[model samples]
Target: MISSNMNVTFENLSDITDDLVIGDQVFTSRLMLGTGKYRNLGVAKQSIECSQTSIITVAIRRLQSSSNFQPNNLLNMLDWKSIWLLPNTAGCTTAEDAIKIATLGHEICKKMGQEYNSFVKLEVIPDSKYLLPDPIGTLKAAEYLISKNYTVLPYIYPDPMLAKQLEELGCATVMPLGSPIGSGQGLQNLENIQIIIENASVPVVVDAGIGTASDAVKAMEIGASAVLVNSAIAQAKFPQLMAKAINLGVHAGRYAYLAERMKKLSRAMPSSPSIGFPN
Candidate 1:
């Protein structure tokens, strides 16, 4: 269980004054990890611990089909008290399929003793090649899920209009993809993502396509509330090390954002005053 003691201490970094508020819950860590694509469950567990992430997203469909759904399964191994389970509707193509998967996700949460946890990472991706989410399907599914009292965090393309629509529809957060899922292309839609962040009242979580620690840093520096990383860490030669790197990047980016940045200039200027210098 995540207690006050488990909260990561940011020494010398006192600028961060607020916690990441999603729905009725508050998370100290802004780096959310995904429990997938790992060499083994042990690696996944170690990576989660190394990342210092309080929230972990699990693909409900994948979990259901896995042979490890026994008494000593992945669910049983996790320290659920401290970790927040974000069951995602992955592998669902249509609104109806997503809704069903979401329902199942809720059940999975309940089984894990989170009866009041209604959070679902909503994804409706029909494009197999790109793995891009379907805007229409996402909206429809989000509406239905919200009506059912689910705290939906919809994954979507970096479309400001669509993001606003989802936010207005009672979504807990608008998760705009930085790029294609598992592509590791980094933030390809910076402008649109910035627009979404600027116009959004809810938190904007940049999901997917985070290749390096720098990618995660850039996302947070640009005012993203959080980021969801999966393949970047899992596919790396050293998953645990990558997790630590990503965690540090998140903190650095958030600190930079809070500290604010210097303005840009078209031309170079002298560092020292010309009048003070000896002629």
Candidate 2:
């Protein structure tokens, strides 16, 4: 139901309601938050509550480490019964590593009584500095995970070709970076992202490099099906308030997109007619 016609008016778009479908699951909120980089789990919880995101991501490594199993445990703090958990292979650098992490994530989900949906965010970033996803490794891992009955959500660069290939490989959703991970660059590669959104058959989620609410707005306005924000909200001075703002921004941008936002004009066009001029 994603249309780029840009021929409709805001008044007529009031009734247009769309759900974000990833694999067999449907989410009402298009803002997908990550459980990382927050001051603490308390802040993360508050942010999650304010964001109203039905889908939240967690690194499988965190879920596996015994250190996080202590008091104020990350997973223990979350209401797993309510929100959908999307475990990611955040630190994985190879397809094999990603596949292994995804498997572990599925097993953890089973142990935690979350077996209804097994969605894993496959991220294979060999580069430590920028943490940008390796498209080849991602594609390889996605294919393997899909075969193993896991709903793969591949994190990748904003390349339309890679997006299509992932979709073809049975990825549930395609997450393209707006900029580098945690860079706060705000869609530096906007043209590429627009292309990804336009061509993707599955949901196009703008992930990483979102610095603020306006960045989220821009992402959704450019036709992103959803936005995956972590550092943007988690690192904010007031994480809870920023989360709320980001959620609202997503809603606004989504509505604007569905409303067939006004086309850009090259020249000025006065709201008042020339005949009604003061002269």
Candidate 3:
């Protein structure tokens, strides 16, 4: 509910550089929005616009022909041509299921766009309570998808060792969760996240568990390449305004990081000179 803009001076603003290059595409906005939890399509579109996010993620599900809702039919309501769709395998638990979902998503992208080239959020969460990503299964899935030549961005816990393995497996990006999915806990493992950011060779996107603009800012301030947030915005009372606030937060975070923050010292300084003078 709070505005992202506060105490930020954009004097030497960082140019929105195309740092995130997935396959042949590059993204400027580090703030990635999820297409789930919005009450309506109109609100989703508005939030996307406000976020200035060129790439947004959406979850895919099998639609029965007899069902009232449709697959691409719903996606079509949005200006799909303007934004890049990153389909996530949210419900997949096994490696096989994840591969199948990736294949289906590739086919769908082919039908939807001329390039037919978009990244996949390869998520393999077995448990329902914690929604923790299965590192072993995730690596298997990422290896398969990367072999298939699909840009893979696998979401995992903030574990540097796991991140190294996934990066070695040829994932386009390694996305680590701030906490649990939709938990809004926000950067529970700051130390591990810093390690991931430090050692990662690829883009490190902090995904899930962010509850506010400040959370997003904190992630970016620590040098995360990007962030993915859904509940903090979509579940808010004013989704559009929340989206704008998030955008500003991301911008503020980016500016702060690029400024290369000053060093910290332990000693306290006296405002007045310590030297005594005759009065």
Candidate 4:
């Protein structure tokens, strides 16, 4: 399924498809992953290669260039052109900071030959403890990002109405939190995600709090456009193995969506009952 060497087959079935188009970029894969917290750069690359991610997220922070050591010592090891490098404003506390950081990221990506047609994950997490999104700041940042000709993907809480609000503000996609960031809760807010997915015209990418492949499948089962996952795979003991699992999960989820989920069972049909037996 990935680069012609993976021997993969599908089993689950549903009616939803996973092809996501953001601006000029069309992604066939629904599994979006993060490029952070791996044991090492080599392992990270291996995980990504195995995961077959379409979009990979990286967090950016301000470095004290003139402070302690030479700024040239900074390391960014990932190859930008190999994948869609999504720069995230992970620790931005305010809307202004978010806008400024995103603008710099947009320009930087262009310098790296990643093209101006890049995506910036607008995250305005005011709290460090809970990692909860600051909706007010997030909305403000979304508006500015939308006006700046950047494809915006704002990570937000599982508030259906707020997701719609962001969608109305010209966002390319609305990323509702699956749980909390790094919580690994896995569809804890299923009702709200379903609501957002049901109403969104743009892609609804489940952004955070997914623990396993089953969680991703559950998100897709409810019509999510795609799922953005990070810690669940990256923090695993064998990240490469976890990546493959997640990849299979996303593929299965997409295929299931396309094949149509089976109807819920009300009463037992009884394979061998008093009425009709095979014997």
Candidate 3 stretches greater than 4 Å from native: 1-18, 62-74, 270-279
Q: Write the per-residue lDDT of candidate 4 for residues 1-279, one digit (tens) a residue.
A: 121222345443333334567766877577899866777767887888888888887675642233312433212545555567788898899999988888777765765577665589999998989999999999998888788788899999989889999999999999999888888889989898888977888888999998888898888767787888889887888889988988888777765665577778998775555755466
Quote model 2's TM-score.
Answer: 0.91
Instruction: Report the lDDT tens digits of candidate 1 across residue range 1-279.
Output: 122223444774454344788999989899999988899878988999999998999989877764746865677788889999999999999999999999989988988889999999999999998899999999999999999999999999999999999999999999999998899999999999999999998989999999989999999999899999999999999999999999999989987886678889999998878896677
Better of 1 and 4 by lDDT: 1
User: What total of clashing residue pairs does each candidate reach?
Assistant: 3, 0, 0, 10
Task: Evaluate residue 102 in candidate 4 and report its C-alpha lDDT on the 0 to 100 scale.
Answer: 88
The residue-by-residue lDDT of candidate 3 on 109-184, one tens digit each, is: 6656735675899999899888999999998989888887889999998889999998988888899999888888
Query: What is model 4's C-alpha RMSD?
Result: 5.3
Q: What value does the lDDT take at residue 138 in candidate 1?
A: 97
| Candidate 2 lowest-lDDT run of ten | 1-10
Pairs of residues at least 3 apart in sequence or in different chains that clash in candidate 2: none
lDDT of 3 at 168: 88
- Scored against the true structure, residue 19 in model 1 reaches a CA lDDT of 76
TM-score of 3: 0.87
What shift in Å separates residue 250 of candidate 4 from its native position after superposition? 0.7
TM-score of each: 0.92, 0.91, 0.87, 0.85
Best by TM-score: 1
Candidate models: Cα lDDT each:
0.91, 0.87, 0.81, 0.79
Sliding window of 10 residues with minimal summed lDDT for model 3: 1-10
lDDT of 2: 0.87
How many clashes would you count in candidate 1?
A: 3
lDDT of 2 by residue, 143-244 (tens): 888888889999999888999999988888899999988888898989999988888888899999999999999999888999999998988999999999
